[model samples]
Target chain A: MIKLLSLIFLILLLIVGKKRGFKTFITFYLSIFLIMMYLTFMKTGLNAIFLAIIICLLATLVTLFILNGSNVKTKSSFISIVFVLLLVTIITVFIGNSANIQGFSLESIESIGYYSHDINYDMTNVIIGMYLICTIGTIIDTSISISSAMYEVHENNPQLNKKELFVSGMNVGKDILSTTINTLYFALISSFIGFFMWFYSVSFDFLSVSKSFDQNIIQLLLSFIASIMIIPITSYISSIMIMKNKK
Target chain B: MKKYLTLKNILIFVISLTIILFVYNDYFLYKTPILKINNIETTVEGYGSYNEKYYNQKITGVIKNGNLKGKIITVNNVTSTSGVNDEQIHKRSELFIKQSNNNIYSIIGVKRDKYIAILAVLFIDLIILVSGIQGVKTLLSLFVNIIISALAIFVFQSNADRLNLLLLYIFVSMIFIITSLFITNGNKTKTYSAIISSIVSLLVSFGLSYLIINIHGRDVTIWTMDYIEYVRDYENYFYVCILLSGLGAIMDISITISSSLNELIDKNFKITKKALLKSGREISKDIIGTMSNVMLYTCFTPIVPLAFLAIKNNMPLMRAINYYGEIELIIVLCSCISIVLAIPISLYISTYILKKYKKEVVK
Candidate 1:
């Protein structure tokens, strides 16, 4: 049943892609399929992580190229975003791995220890790898956004100086801050609503819940805070790079 | 601005007093079994005390509602473990009560729903104060979205066929995307473009995930851990989760792209198709990275603590990743896939549809 449903879904995507025209549909389907392939074939932690990084970067490049093909401004911004992403990924891994936030096992693990125990691998590396995989998408998204908006501002007022362009980028960043934060927070919270329900079902009081805020919640909070913190950094870098290229 | 006390202030004061009185009267003097603090070590055996590490408190409270109203009860309130700080119950805290045969009630745990509600109220208030009417509309849209989601879940749960659930979800999500976009932007062209791009992107990602799950057939048993047996019975719930996980980020990106494109078209009616396409690309390049970050981080948040747990337990990274981290990994992957598609999806639809329609509508 699951396989049949999946096949149907695949066919639908093809139809939609076909109807929409080849450029949009081909990359749209290919990018997703390639990522899925990497995830399927790569069992080792490091292999999967490296492949994911490559896949994400490729997707960013392809999408940006298709949307704005060989545009210097877009390409430069993409490079800047990639540089910032590399930096952020290192920082996140270093901080996250050593933070000791992984000390507490999730409640789900307590019951199904069998599944995880069967694998003989460096789970720590995998955890870090997963963090990198998760963190990269947002970093790419943020840098691209800041750069594009700044480019638009420059286009609108060709005479606007570098400093003015930088300021304009900051303004765009400010307008998006709240909604971005809300989307991030809401997405996490909504997914964990069931997890929260479990805690409540167990009669864990506020203080108890707080006490049990544990590794998972802490890690989540840290990841989000770190991601949000990167927005300004990426925005700043992208704006500066775009401004320099304007001349 | 008079110095004298106003009606709102007086009313707040009265409500405060009433709450204080209620807590004191109901939790204290009127109840038979009363909670008393212990400065020394004490342990209460059975279901709540198996951990042996938590500081157990003997709690006493009267049944304030239901058939066993006014009946006093005493039970061990176990402190939840693993949090950075200890969780303690307070006067305003609500507890889940279970009644035994002899009219005795078990104070299972603290009711967290109320606290969550209180926090949400505070969050909404802050938004309203800062953004004014815009915040209210955002808040209303959020509430409606929640209601609609709950309705979707109810409908899905009542039905048995997995295919129906999937189809229902697609239909429901279509409604969701349209309604949410309409509420947030209210411009038909932008809304239409956003809805189309979002759904298309969602379909592609969801399809890929379904493919991954079917072909590999890896150990998804981690999802069925703890007390979540329902996932085992209803596999489609997992797909539902995958589908909805990135909806917000995808919608946000599509809307941001479409709306920005609409603005560009409005700015220059005489702009050529090539320039317009370039502008659309420019817009996407700026937004896609940040928007993708939003999606990735949301999925990554849950994994942080799980990693911490594995580290602390002396569990190897491989084992932990296999069991605890798989779901988080898949969610991130699904979201990234959707986000990648959203950029082009939004760009093409917005450029093609908005440009074609703009000359006629003159908006």
Candidate 2:
């Protein structure tokens, strides 16, 4: 039933894409296959990883057809790449068929293990979901919009030097940066406000409490630092990438 | 430094901070104390002393309709926890409660180097002030996303059923995308293009992630981290959830970068389709540069605590924190796979958005 709904959703999404003038029907189809294939075939080991990468690259080229269905230029190299990936994947699957696929067992039911008991992880994930779904996603979207403004500035006036366009992009990025970062920080705060309460409620001595996890307050401090670190990094990366095209 | 300041920027910072502070104050700082001694009923002899007011507080409580209605007392000392230095100590003292039984619980705060707030303010101020209208749109979208997340836990996502958990995430995700894209692009053909592109990119990442994890021997239950504690023990929901979670951000980034590039090319008739596609691919390589790390940093946030424990115990990096601790492994692999998938997803979506947009203009 889940599968049926997802399939229907995919179909509906594709039809909508068509109606809206965005191509990608076939790529969309391949993605569905990829999801199923992964659930069925892949593992996280090196070999499984290699297999998945092959499938993804091959599938992406096929997406070109989705974008411009028929009567479109087909890059020969792209086709060849897909063919080779398929060939390799088939061979690997045959060779690596020894992986045990056990039927659902009552034993598998008895001891479901570790995470089934972690309170911290549960609460953290709710926040993480918010971060991923909203905060990070928002920043990225704004980055794109900033990039658009830059792209427009450059394209409309090719005379604008690379530096000017870069500046323009930066300008737009700067516009989004403040609220975007605010949103990010606030999201972090709200997510872990409990941790703060835990921190303070027991006399600001985070040392003993800190010792309880593989990660501690220091790590939280660092990761939050890292989150801050991404702001400049993303901005700079986009700016530099655009600058390279000009040179 | 000064470039980040302005009334509008300051206003944004001040507003958000003020709101955060008010909420923090009411929730964490505000206090109401109600104290009671085990056998100390109403004082008979000190009734006159209670009226002689050294009390610093106004206290009110009532025994409802039955009999204690409108029983009110104006107080001085709360529950007598306060020390009395009086040589002529009042024979009877006003009694008060330190905290009421049902009143909200509150806690003291940690003192940080004050620099943190300044940095955050500057950072936020810079974003809202610089982005102008777009900044506001992004900010509003962030709030909406929070609401969506809040609902995901209580209203939608149930770790009890792995399948429902997955669907719930996907549904919430769609709502998030629709909200942000609509806000950022406004109502137009372009917004529609961005939406289609965004969805396609997400699907691409999802596909590749699915392939990698299954091929790699990841246990579905492994992804739920520590589920039995929070939701239910048998929940295999997170195996799918974390991957989907990672996919959303990566997908969002890819579509965004690609669409912006497409818009650039569209504005310039000279930028041919091949050039545009090449540009998207090239830009993706650059996005991959840091984005891969972003994924790592993202994974680090939760598992960082685990890593800290490992380090303090002098655990070897591998065995110390158990990098592949089933849950962390799920996150690490999921984010990594999603990061890798993001590249092609962005490329494919951008190509489609631009080409299709071109076709529509012609039609």
Candidate 3:
């Protein structure tokens, strides 16, 4: 029954894509298949995080190519986003370790073993893995947006100096920054309403809950802070690189 | 604007009153101390100790709601093994009660809904102050999403045997997409583009996720998360979680792409179709980074700290990765996949629709 439903949904997706043209329909279909193939074929091992990152990057590459064609400028922006993600991933690991925010805290759940009890899950690596995986999408998204904005600005006024073009890129980045942060914040807050409810229901006073510094809350704070921090990095990098390429 | 000020002031006043009442209720609102605190203090000092704890505070209060109203009750306000205070009961706190023969009532647990509601209100107030009218609409949509989700859960609980849960989720996802986009955007070309793009992106991501789950899913079983054992159909819970998690981020990206495309098209009607398509792709590049980052951070919020805990426990890297990283990896990947795919999906759909619209205008 589930299989039939899914097949029906896929058919609907294809039908929708067909209206746009064969390129739209085919690329859309292939994108879905490509991602699914990565998920199925990848080995679940110590390097699983890296594997997932690479697959996601590949998917993004394919996506960018499909939408924008194989432009040198687009490729450069993609590289820049991946570079930033690597840097951010390193920083996230450092923060995660020093903060000691791992494991199922007594606050969030009754047990620590989400997997089999006999298995000793490498939770530190898991933190690193999750961080890296989560970071890729945002980094890729931000890089593309900044790069795109810079290109558009340059296209509109071809005579603008590199410095001026860089400024325009910054301006576009600024506009995108505020809204993106709120989207992250609100989405995070809303998704975990049930968790908050649990805390309050257990009669955890505001002070206690805030002060406890549980892994769950720390995770949110870390993700929230790290995500916001990446914006300027990607924006500036993409802005400078795109502007410099203009010369 | 002045009327808005009055409304804002009233909200502030109400919030202040609640805080005051909360403090008063915990301390001096009702002076007759029906329940006394059995303050038992204990201290255990050393490495890995539970904070050299002290003082278990047991307080008794009268039942103020339901059939047991006006009954005296005894409840633990705090349970501490060392000098540290573990938890505190507040004035607006609600409790579950058990009735014994002699009017002696035992507090079962704290009722959490009221407190959650209060926190939710605080969140709503903040949104209003920050975004104004749009914030209110966001809040309404949020309320609707919550209602629909809650109803779905209720349905799931009541009729797990009767329904194909996956279909129900797909249905709910459609409602969520339509209601969320329409409320925020009204009926516009941009809104339709966002809705179609988001749904298509979601389906692709979910389809891929479904395939991944079937092949490499044994290690990351449903047992790893909370609320599974009690669920009859615990197997589908993870998929449901993935589906729900991606919705906000996917919708967000689609909306960003569509809005940008619409703005660009409106500004440059004379631009060629090729340029428009190229520009749409460029706009997606701008959106993909921050939007994806928003998604990553949202998923990372709770999991990062848990990673830290494993480190503290001296859990080996490979083992920790195997146990914790595996499951979290699947989740992050699935959600991120949706977000990444959403960019192009939105770009292509918007480009095609806007091109058609432009040609129509020319005729």
Candidate 4:
């Protein structure tokens, strides 16, 4: 079933996206392979957070430079994305430690009940790594959109000054902000629909369900927060970098 | 003007800070008895044949709710460094505690709503500060949508045995699409065009996948899916998942194409349909890659750790994929298919609505 779906997906990509679609297909699998490699590396007891950051940087490079091609827009967006990612990473570490939301939820532990728990890796760092990886996709998408739109605005009106360009970038960000947030919100909701349904089945009370917030809800909200915080920063940085490149 | 702006900024900052501070100390808000840990004595315990190191913490704390609002309490917690099922009890951590029959208090999970509240406040403040009124509208729409979704869940839960999950979600998806676009884009022709295109593309792509799944008639084992142990009818639930998961990306593509094409026509009414289609294709090409990337990452990244755990425990990679990764893979692929299919459908619908029909009316 999976094979048939992948085949249909690939054929559709070739039909609609053509060459770029083909590149996207490759990049999609490449990212999956990269994540698998990242998880495998985590098992070797390396600094999970550090390795996550590096892998994130690599993923960004592959997605931006390779898929979008190395251009002024990709470069500036890359810089902004890296900056936002690092900032979000610091926030994740702080929240992960303070909130103590590490490890599997009680629901998840049921599935993995028979598995050995002596993997000897700190689940807190692993959780932080997961948070970082989960958020990088949206960050890249937003940053690239801002940078590319700013690039086009500059191209159409070269007379626009730095402040004007920055404001324009921000206006674009604002326009897309709602949709982007919607995308993230729905993505999070749909992914966890099963778990939510399970909660209903067990007849967990509202308060206890809220208590389960530490599991998936916290991660979802944190990602939303991270994506929201990245917008203005990316707009500002991409604008400045784009303006500076013209001089 | 600059002074006023600065003052507003300062006021927002101060308000955000106060909210964070209040949430940080909001122990009295929770109905459950809260424990503010003052100290911990940790001893390592050897467990099982593996001699795994587990920390048994003798924790003492002050109760911050109910009859023992100021009284001290003690509990024992065994936690591993991995912190999978049990967590290391940190000093200064606030916890929910329950009294056992022996009159001894036992620790529940950590009280984490304070952190969640703090993050929510920061997000709201940042949105309001940066985007101002538009941000507020976006938040309002989000709130409305969330309430709608909650209501849908409630209805579904009560009628799970009677209702077809896929049909219920289809109804929910339409409400979501219309409500979201109307709130975000307002009452414009472009918005109308987007609404029509999104609904058409959603139904078309969803119908295609539904037909394909029915033809392929292999029953998916729901036991491998996370947190789905309670679900009885996997087929309907599986279809619902595909439909709901793909709805976002499809709507995103539809709106992007429709809005951009409408903008193109608005900019130059004399533009040809061919030109509009070309431009729509160009925009679709740019967005499709990243949009589908979003689907891929969002759908698949959460399973990385679980798959890792399975593989690390000597489960074969193929077995791990079969057990845990298959459903997510199908979801992402189906979403990507809808995203791909949405591009041309939206382009054709938008171009025809904005150009051909409008031109006939103008003539």
Task: Provide a comma-separated list of chain B TM-scores, one per candidate.
Answer: 0.78, 0.63, 0.78, 0.92
C-alpha positional error of residue B354 in candidate 4 after TM-score superposition, expressed in Å = 1.7
**Model-by-model DockQ, in order:** 0.10, 0.03, 0.08, 0.60
Compose the digit string of candidate 1's lDDT tens values, residues B5-48. 76754664565555545543443332223332222234533332
User: Which sections of candidate 1 miss by over 4 Å?
Assistant: A1-182, A185-247, B1-54, B60-73, B78-94, B99-105, B161-163, B215-219, B222-228, B231-233, B360-363
Q: Sorted by TM-score, highest first, which candidate order results?
A: 4, 1, 3, 2
- Candidate 2 docks with a DockQ of 0.03
Model with the higher lDDT, candidate 1 or 2: 1
Model 4 lDDT tens row, A74-184: 988888888888888888898888888777766666777988887766778887888888888888887888888889999999999888988898888887778888887
What is residue A192's positional error in candidate 2, in angstroms?
A: 7.9
lDDT per residue, candidate 2, B1-363, as tens digits?
787686665677678687556532231122222221122232322221223322232333321122222344332222121111111112121122232334432211112212233334443454454455666676576667657665565453334344465566567666766776676667764566656665766666666555555665543444224323333322435434553446445535554565566566656755766777666654444343223333332443344323322332344544433442445444544554454455555566666666666543331
lDDT of 2 by residue, A1-247 (tens): 2233234334443332333222322333344354334323321112333444444454444443443233212232233334433443342232122111111111122232221211111112222221221112232334334544555566678787656665666665554443333323332322232233233334433322122121222222333332333334334444455555667
For candidate 3, lDDT tens digit of each residue in B1-363? 676678666877688568645643452322222232233233332222423233344555665544454656565433332111123333434444456556555543444323333334444554455445666676577667768766766676568689866778788888988888897778888788889998999898888778756764345555545434445555665676677777777888788778877776777777776887776665444443344334543453334334434433555544544454455445655665676667677878877776665433332
Best by DockQ: 4
Worst 10 residues of 1 chain B by lDDT: B30-39
Better of 1 and 4 by lDDT: 4
- TM-score of the second chain, cand. 4: 0.92
lDDT of 4 at B320: 77
| Interface RMSD, in order shown | 9.5, 19.6, 10.5, 2.0
Q: Stretches of candidate 3 above 4 Å error?
A: A1-110, A113-247, B1-55, B58-119, B304-311, B358-363
Better of 3 and 4 by TM-score: 4
Total backbone collisions for each predicted model: 42, 46, 43, 0
TM-scores for all predictions: 0.60, 0.50, 0.59, 0.95
